[model samples]
Target chain A: MTYCVGLLLDAGIVLLSDTRTNAGLDNIATYRKMFLFEEPGERAIGIMTAGSLSITQTTMARLTDAIEEGDSPKSIMHAPTMLQVAEIVGGMLSDVTSEVSAKMERMSQNATASMIVAGQRNGGPMRMFLIYPEGNFIEATADTPFLQIGEHKYGKPILDRVIAPGTSLADAEKAVLLSMDSTLRSNLSVGMPLDFAVIEANSLEISRRRRIEADDEGFSRMSAAWSEALRNAFQQIDPI
Target chain B: MTYCVGLLLDAGIVLLSDTRTNAGLDNIATYRKMFLFEEPGERAIGIMTAGSLSITQTTMARLTDAIEEGDSPKSIMHAPTMLQVAEIVGGMLSDVTSEVSAKMERMSQNATASMIVAGQRNGGPMRMFLIYPEGNFIEATADTPFLQIGEHKYGKPILDRVIAPGTSLADAEKAVLLSMDSTLRSNLSVGMPLDFAVIEANSLEISRRRRIEADDEGFSRMSAAWSEALRNAFQQIDPI
Candidate 1:
């Protein structure tokens, strides 16, 4: 299981992804799930993937291969807008998923994957999308300005109630971390050393990238604070 | 979709269930998912249902019928121990599920249902069980002292972090309400007018049952407070 979230905020985009991947309980491993594509001042995109590692890796490889094909790259870097970039990523992910699912079927296994792609291009608005396994996608709008992939439900409540387009970039990042923290507490399959990134609006450059480990002091502090607040709130409620 | 949760604590047990039943987004109606059977001071059983409403309703009716059986009451009141009561409920629920599934299959439908049964008999220890579609069930233990059925993921995080065998009964109730509150916010398929019940250890009877409506003031206040805390926490975090 994986938990990757992307938020579209007034100031920028915040992206976070867990690094744990497992074929079975005993076959756990850490694999970075976020991929960054940047041409410095030209374009910057961050993708956080979940589901089948095979499909996501392949899709991301294809995207990178295209970016490197820069005698006029035809990937997200060269796309006219973020929407087109989403279309390209969606198509690539879907294709890879179908191919991997077919191979996994031979062993009676299942292939499932999805990706969260967000960034700013030279000429387009900073955008965020939840690209499904089927190659179709939906963009974040003002009303619901964030998208999540992989083991989403455990963390969805916080996202739904608090995230919006007007949310500050700082708040948005905290929201995604808290959301991820929720998932981490509930699911053993999703462990840490997280991959986090931020892309300032109109910057056309990835502003920040972080690898948040399990023992990271900031995260530990945040979790403790949240738990204390919850305990406090629970005590305040009128008893039955 | 339904959301039903049961917590086994030193103080006793807490059972919570939402009442909304929907065939799809457009067709929804209210139906209580909780049923209580108490031969006060002798025993108290709280059955919270999720999944196929038809199968669950039938299962609940069967349990009630068994309790009212004069000659051979396969009832919680008559059972020698809490475990016996669990077996009776599990067997009946399993039987009803298969019968309904067979009938539904003939009409091109599916039968999927699950339940959380929490109860205590006068001479037995308090136990909470999660009965599966197949009728097999598992009791909560010290390490995992809670079970949730139907659309569980959305509300699971809070429970995972907050619930424990030693958790105060008052805290347990608040934990579940907050959990239900989270599920309600994220999954449209799971809705309001929830039924929440509490069983005090060794009391052999339910101590409280509250019906929280869509506009329940306490819930609204609690949600508002939670959101504010989240926002405040976000603001407190040092920006990256």
Candidate 2:
């Protein structure tokens, strides 16, 4: 299981993902699930994936290969808008998923993956999408400015309460981290060494990027503070 | 779908469940998910169920019929210990599930249900078990003194942070209610008109029972207070 969240705030887009991947309890491994496509002032796209590692890795490889070939309509780098980039990624993801799922079907295994694509093109509006295994996708709306994939429920209550289109970029980043923190505490399959990215709206570039290691003092302090705050909050509530 | 939680504390057992049932988004109804069986001074057992309503209702009917027949060993009233009562309930549930599932197989429908059983019989220690659809059950231990059924993840983080065998019954009740509140906010399938009960250890009877309606002022105040507390807590956490 994985836990990744993307928030589309008026100020920017915030994306976060954990790197833990496991085939089973005993076969856990660390694998980066965040892919960045950048053209500095032209375009910047961040893709966070969850589900079958094989499918996601293959999809990423294929997307990268397309970009390297250059000028391909299917390449995210050449896509005219954020929505077109999402379509290109979704198309690649769907193709990879079908190819892998067909082979897995013989053994009754699942090879589907879901992804969150967030970014902007120079003249286009910043956008975020949740792409399903079937390649179809839905964009984040003002009423629901955040999208989450994989092991989502444990971290959802907080996001449901805090995130909004009007939220500041800083607050949106904090919300996604705290959401990831809740998931990490409750789910073993989602672990440390998280990838976080912030894209200031219309900048067409990742304004900030971070790789939070397991022993990062900032993350530890934030996590401890959140826990302590929750305990205090719980204690303050009146007993029935 | 449903969300029910049971917490075993040194002082007592706290059980709470939402009363919503839905076949789909368009077809939803309220159905009681909590069942209480008490011989007052002799024993008290509370069963909170989730999953297929047909299987759970049928299992409840069979257990009621068994108890009505009086002297039978399989009857919860005659069970020698809380563990035995769990076994009796588990057996009935498994039987009903299999019967219902076999018939549903023709239509390719799922017919499985899970339950949380908490109780104490005279001369026995208080116990709580999470009974699986297969009839096997696992008791809550001092290390993990809480059990949840149905849409559990949304409500799990708070319980993991606050619940323990050493927690006070008052605090335990608050924890479960807050947990249910989280689930209600995140899941449309788990809704209002909740059933709550408290059983003091060794008393062999429920000490308190409340049906919290949607319009209950106290519950509404608590919910509002909790949401405010969470938002305040989120704000206090340092940004990453």
Candidate 3:
């Protein structure tokens, strides 16, 4: 299981993802699921993936190969707009899934993978899209300012309560973190070394990116503070 | 889809379920999912169901019929302990599922259901059990004070944050309501009205039973107030 969420707000976009991937209970491994594509002052894109790691890793490899072949139409940097970039990424992911699933067929294994492509073009507004395994995608709306993929349920309540169109980049990040934290505790399939990124509005650059390890001091403190806050909140409520 | 949660706390047991049943996007109907078999003061058993309404409704009807019968081994009231009650409920649910599934096989339908049963048998401590379709059940421990069935993911975060053996009944009720409200907003398949019951500690009887309809003033008020409170909470947190 994986938990990845991207929130589009008035201030900016926030992306968070967990690194834990497993083929089974005992086959656990850590693999980064977030990739950044930025041509500094021109365009910045953050891609977070959840689902089959093989498909996502292969998709990323092909994307990097395209970028390395600078003049190729398949490159993320040369994509005309955020929408096209999403389409390109979706196409690549779908292709990888199809190719890999064919090979895994004899083993009776599934090769499904989904990705969220969030970014901005130099001349366009920031946007976010959730790409499905079938290569289709959906954008965030004013009423639903965020889109989540993989093991989404365990963290949905907080997002429903706290996220909105006008939420600031920082607050959006916190919301996603708390959301990831909730998923981590309730779902063994989703584990640690969380990847988080923030894209400031109008910057066309990746503002901040950090990896939160299992024993990271800041995450520990935040978890403790949130738990204490909840305890206090419960104490203040008049129990019937 | 459905959402039903039962919590065993020191104050009492609170069971809540949303009353919505859907065969598809266009085929949704209002169907109560919470069933009660209480011989007031002697014993009170509250059962909440999720999944195939046919299986659950039939199971509850059988349990009710057995209760109404003067002499029968197939009754919740006649069960020796909370465990026996769960076994009886689970057996009924599994039986109903097998019968219905066989009938629906020609039409290619699946009879699936899950239940959370909470009650006290006069001398037994307030107990809660999650009965599987296979007649297997697990009792709630202090470490896991609650069990949820049906559209459980969306509402799980709140329960994880606030529920415990020490949590007040009022807070527990609020947590479950907010959880259900989250699911109601995110999943079109789960909706109102809702059935809520509170069993006071050692009473062997339900102290309160209420139906919260779509237009219920209090529920509406709570939902609005909660959304507002969340907005306030968001505003209070410094950006990031």
| Off by more than 4 A, model 1 | A72-74, A106-108, A237-240, B106-108, B237-240
- Arrange candidates by DockQ, descending: 2, 1, 3
Model 2 CA deviation exceeding 4 Å by range: none
Candidate 2's displacement at residue A182, Å, is 0.6
Q: Score residue A48 of candidate 3 by CA lDDT.
A: 90
- For model 2, what is the alpha-carbon lDDT of residue B24? 83
lDDT by candidate, in order shown = 0.84, 0.92, 0.85
The TM-scores of all predictions, comma-separated, are 0.94, 0.99, 0.94
Kindly report which residue pairs in candidate 3 clash with one another: A170-B240, A171-B240
Ranked candidates, highest TM-score first: 2, 1, 3
Measured by DockQ, the strongest candidate is 2
Leading candidate by TM-score: 2
Indicate the docking level reached by candidate 2: high
Fnat for each model = 0.41, 0.80, 0.31
TM-score of predicted structure 3? 0.94
- Tell how far residue A2 is off in model 2, in angstroms: 0.7
| Model 3 C-alpha lDDT per residue in residues A43-66, reported as the tens digit of each score | 999999988887898999999999
lDDT of 3: 0.85
